[model samples]
Target chain A: MNSTKGEKIFYGINYFVLLLIGLTCVLPLVHVLAMSFSDKHAIASGAVSLWPVNFDSSGYSALFDETPIFKAFRNSLIITVVGTALNVLFTVLAAYPLSKRYFIGRRFYSLAVVFTMLFTAGLIPNYLLLKSLGLLNSYGALWLPGLVSVWNLMILRSFFEGLPEELEEAARIDGSSEWRLLSQIILPLSGPVIAAISLFYGVTHWNAFMNVLIYINDTNRQNLTVLVQQLIQNQSFMQEMANTQPEMAAKLTPEGVKAAGVIVMTLPMLVLYPFLQKYFVKGAMIGAVKG
Target chain B: MSKALPPPASAITNPSQEQARTRSNWLVRKYGKRVLKQNVPLYLMFLPIMIFFLVFKYYPMTGLVIAFKKYSFLKGIWGSPSAGLHSFQMIFNNDQMIKIIWNTFKLSGLSILIGFPLPIILALLLNEVRKMIFKRFIQTFVYLPHFLNWVIVGGIVVTVFSQNETGVINHVVKWLTGSTFPFLYNETSWTSIFIASGVWKEAGWSAIIYLAALTTIDQSLYEAASIDGANKWQQTIRITIPAIMPTVIIMLILKIGHLMELGFDQVFVLQNDAVSNVAEVISTFMYKIGIQQANFSLATAMGLFESIVGLVLVLTANSIARRFGQGLW
Candidate 1:
């Protein structure tokens, strides 16, 4: 609690450096926000920095009018919601059985699961396998392959294992099935872990990119990540957008539209940012402590 | 994915063994049948997961045989003819492949060199902060980019570093120096931007683990050290660093394990036509060759090589860590 003069200087430098670092992290996003809201002419003239020069919502209006950003948003939502539900379900089913001390061949099963994390089939084989299964170009391609995340399953397994065994014994004495015991007793006590794992899966699904790029052939099926990436990377896509909305071509710039697309794609994360920070730190701590 | 270590194997006596030891039919019927009946639901619960692993994970692993085969789409995985080591031979013979592999190693090595230690330093610095509100604000901002997918981050990077008037940095540079620098277009600058952006994105998120490690440290140790006339610097070096060395080592080992996988999405998004020479890595190369061009055999061979090297690296790193008495297993 006591600070020397040297300690005081160190603290001063520390705060200044940290404040600078924090600003570096946030100022770019702020810049993009400003660019997204700035007039096309102002953005073209490079007048925008951390604040908008001529505040306008026309970039977003143009983005919505010309691009399939709304479709991408809906697809992202479906994948995140449905994928997280399946993730939680499969994670629970697998974790419950593995948690039991008396379960047969549990070590073999756990090792089988964990080994996948160590070395995977990589992209080509996984893609080929998906192709063979007729899962390509469908949302099933996205969800089915990563149905039960090994990491989440491991966390949930530990959580389930840590639950009071007396509850299970008590349920067994009353002729409750293992299913009923898991649903009624184990899950009710695992709200925190489940919530954390859901957020984990939810974020992954929301950010789904490479898989969508590989498996989903239909542009209509693409999620916001891929769609935003298209708008950013593909100059031709911007050209196509301009052609689609020729009336607004003079009023729209690629920079403004791209920045708007970035914001739109990130809007959900921005909304969820507070909850994400709280739970994700908790989730990381749980994994580290129990890992 | 999951970092949860396997729990110590339970040594409960097997009910089947007990049933075998008993000569009486009644005991066998009671113990064996009841055990089987009770566990039926559990086995049932585990069945679908097993199927998923078999079909999606294990089956694809087996399908890696295409790496050694002349794969044909119509002929399928099973119908393809064996090419033995031809695909791997092609990989070694190709100059571009060599460059890509080197690029993968160089990028990842540079990333680890630059990106690895910052989080530890950031964590230590954050630990010294006296103001909770200030600490929270810094953390919130720093962790913001991690929540964003690479697409958004990549878009921001491109926008900020673009060569033209829209680029914020270039605009500032142009005003100051009367010339705009090519941050993304030039190879040297692109590499710098790549590594810097990676640090910017992940350094804060990675610090959380170190902060968590720091929390378990005893305050009395610091109190006693300060009472003994040790300065804050001396306290950190003598007390805090030693305290978190195991964590540092473990994190280092895990990081080394992922040396081969530089992550495709970030590179794919950040890379431009002008800088692809330095930017192309194994994953992106595989995407172009295998997925886009349908050169399945060659791409699979490359993928197989990456996976094997990664597995070897992890094992080697773990073994090295074991010598320091900090095996991940």
Candidate 2:
């Protein structure tokens, strides 16, 4: 596999261009991290960019002191954990039966699921539905409406269809019922697809804010995303806080606190991203191609 | 549901038509009962998902009737008075309608034009890379932004493009031109910023599909092209491009189908009062009118309009794709 001089030059240029594009993605994140650690006075003075200037931990400390922020963080955690579990359970149950060739009304059930991907009830009806159900302002408001994602269902169904039918037949011959076959035989063989879909559901739940904003009026029930959005968008909130607590203003500038909030909210995803990268790529490719 | 059940097996197998007619009735009943009894477990496993979809998805579809009604909270959806296209008329006659529609089209059109091609080009470039680790590293970095929600990205956008001296782009512009640009507020700059951020956020993730498509391309084609004295650029243009054309067309059709959406989260977070003229899109507008103002009918009307346009676009695009031999179905 010897390459020509021209091919060598093309490869060189490709490497350089890709490295530059990669940095464009990373630098802004680095800048945010730098600003989050910089002193409030230095941040206000517009000195920080790529690195911390007059470094301090006041912003982080201030965020830690805010009970509402912790509550929001806990809320996001609960929603993500419980929500992802429900999503995985529903998706597996639906996909397994639908994937079976002998399952009655498989086509009808699949079409019903796939229809939701193309069309939605929009926001108002969804909100009204939750409100009428007395689920608003509760944890159910966060995850109940989205208990089963159609896109995930399609992906999981495709994965299940790809599995060997002989394995299921063997389990059935061993007197395993449909439920036992799914739990004891099929599920254990479905680790990769399940992991990938679980990550998708987890990320969606963790990053959900629109549903929270519409349904949860109570502050304690809100997620980190909504809190971070409010903190970043409402610069006036910091000013109002300064007016009320003059001394506290010196320790936390709006920009510094906002950068801190962004970091805290985004850190979990970033940490989990590396470990999940391969599964994410595999799952996404499976989805894009088959979907 | 009963109508969906298959006819009796004896109906198809019977040799004598006259005898078949008489026996079919009894066989149909027996077959239906037998099938039901046999597949009960499968249906039981499927019941929860069916119930979920019925409650959340189909139920809300029925609620679309609110678009035609006054939508009083006191008098529920059924009890509300029929408005008879009042909301539709209100939306069409509104002064902001033209600007909102124009802005939505402009933003989505520009995004499709620019955002669609970058991923293909990036995938092509990455394909040219000889080293696997370097290619993987580039992909890892690029795919990072796709995982982040708009709120965090919006925060970063605000930080980088703020009018204040602390804003990174403004800081550099001030140093270079002795003046600062209002990236978020001005119409032209705001739209550019929106598209630019969109490209930044999705270009890497979108490239994954193209890259996957690229892998399916036979290496023999490239070797054949090379033997024909086709250079890298020529092979790319002639062979590589054609190999992935079906995928490219399918993705483009899907993107066009979602033209009206414009991503509610991205647009909502990036939008501000100052840039409302260029920034207000159909989804955000619907949210404001429907949720914020409690003008349920108008909001629902707007949503219905958006959905109808979306359905028409997808159907048209899918049909067009089929005509070109690359239909999604």
lDDT of each: 0.90, 0.87
lDDT at position B113, candidate 2: 98
* Model 2: per-residue Cα lDDT over B240-289, one tens digit each: 99988988998998899889888888998899999998899988887777
Clashing pairs in 2: none
Q: Which candidate tops lDDT?
A: 1
lDDT of 1 by residue, B27-121 (tens): 44655766767778999999999999999899899889999999998899889999999999999999989999999999999999999999999
Residue pair clashes in candidate 1: A151-B2
How many pairs of residues collide in each model?
1, 0
Candidate 2, lDDT over the whole model? 0.87
Q: After superposition, how far is residue B312 of candidate 2 from its true place, in Å?
A: 0.9
True-contact fraction per candidate equals: 0.84, 0.66
- The DockQ assigned to candidate 2 is 0.70
iRMSD computed for candidate 1: 1.3
